[model samples]
Target: MKKSLFAPIFASALVLGLSACGATAETAEGDTATAVEAAQPAVYADLGGEPTGPVYRMAKADTLAVSGFDVVSYFTGDGVPVEGSEEFTVRYQGYDYRFASEDNAKAFIEDPAKYAPAYGGYCAWAIGANDALAPGDPNVYKIVDGTLYLNFSEDVATRWNKDIPGFIEKADVNYPTHTPDEHYQD
Candidate 1:
């Protein structure tokens, strides 16, 4: 697929602070842009799923409920709080969105798993092949050890379903060390 010329530089600026002053630009090669986009979490289809619940203050045993979709509620069993409470926003993947609060957003900053989409929230096919982040399906998710994870589109989820145990095995291997944010920008 042809990529936007400015996507890579833009993505790079997003993840790796472009300058000490924070000035950024978008002017990357098409291939570079494609590469950057390929490394990000899957894009969500705008379905406006039910609001699970608004972001709330982190409390003992309280996990940030999945805001947009009806997935698992907690981020971890240890009660490690996820999601920031302050009202701040960022462009995740390519979506212009806002978290309920900064605390909920900060939770993700501290530990992305607490807020990152499920199934690694990446493309299942790409994950299966260990290739790249595939666009995700918000509805397909899993809660492991209390942390929620999202997967790629349902089609990919269906493929993952074929070998549930195996897919999880690979995902487990990929999750901790292979964080998705290491790849993209806004």
Candidate 2:
């Protein structure tokens, strides 16, 4: 099946900065001006399913969640995160997540919330401590209880460790301020 080329474009806008419901655009010609219809809520059916919750923050490059890292790898095996394989990729929460193997993909399909990162994969320090949006580095991560959390970097990760429990508490309270699919809310 063919993919929806427009989905990524709208999804990118949603990730970078755009309205949660839909984005608007304008066009003008001669003297008459027209406001084009706002982007429809993209279904992303080709991504395996429609987005269910808050929009996931994609990695800066290639726009893949966890920068294409296999989220399932964080919990299984040696506990070392591994690069995901294109052959076994799955889309969850509006982001395409790659896996190291088919089993990993199946595992993710079984329970996405269990493997998905906190704060929509935004930086733990930024969300909890600052209530801000910052890129999360898949390389710097931690599994607290059964939930996964990603930090901006080693330095930020170190800072976050200073008060993991406190930060988690603050993040939980702050996270809901913005809509699930939005990085920041009005």
Candidate 3:
């Protein structure tokens, strides 16, 4: 008898699909769109001006920074935001980061400033545009001068690309103003 190695993988995929379907069906009135929108984790939401020091922009329910994506992989690997595993993790500036490998995690611990995204993982374009704090999509990013900049979306990223240097300058000036201690004041 011939044995297929893909059997387990296929079964796992099927299980995941079925579970996802179950979740979709459980939404009120079969409103998949509303369910999806509600299911999405907000990038950042103001918590009554509560102070968080220098922590990165993370969802209230999220414990990992950059939505648990490996930051080091963006620079060392294919520049694709790969999800990080809990096995290899690090905590910096009140935010936890997961890494694809222990080596990446160690590299981050060695020089966190080198790997952490700019503007505290908030949307770079929004910072430059109006000093607004918006959730940054890890997938929509760029590495300029060894610095990673994330945007709210592809459209916002395109706007930032129009003048990267100019926007960077503006963002640099505006970032400090939006720091947790600075912006979260009454």
My TM-score estimates for the predictions, one after another, are 0.39, 0.68, 0.66
Candidate ranking (lDDT, best to worst): 2, 3, 1
Clashes of each: 25, 4, 0
Q: Looking at candidate 2, what is the lDDT of residue 44? A: 24
Better of 2 and 3 by lDDT: 2
RMSD of each: 14.2, 10.9, 14.1
Top lDDT prediction, candidate number: 2
* Per-residue lDDT of candidate 2, residues 37-132 (tens digit): 333322222235554334444422233577778999999888899988776767775577888888888888888889988887788888899988
Sorting all predicted structures by TM-score, with the top scorer first, yields 2, 3, 1
Error of 1 at 76 (Å): 12
The digit string of per-residue lDDT tens for model 1 on 54-123 reads 2211121112223333222244345332333223444333332334444444554455435555443454
- In terms of TM-score, the best-performing candidate is 2
Q: Tens digits of per-residue lDDT for model 3 on 1-186? A: 013435645645665666667644344566554334444333222112233433444434244678889999999856788988877767665567788887888888778789989987888898888877777889999999999998989999999999999989998898876545332111
- The alpha-carbon lDDT assigned to residue 33 of candidate 1 equals 34
Off by over 4 Å in 1: 1-3, 7-87, 90-98, 106-112, 118-120, 129-132, 174-186
- Model 3 global lDDT (CA atoms, 0 to 1): 0.71
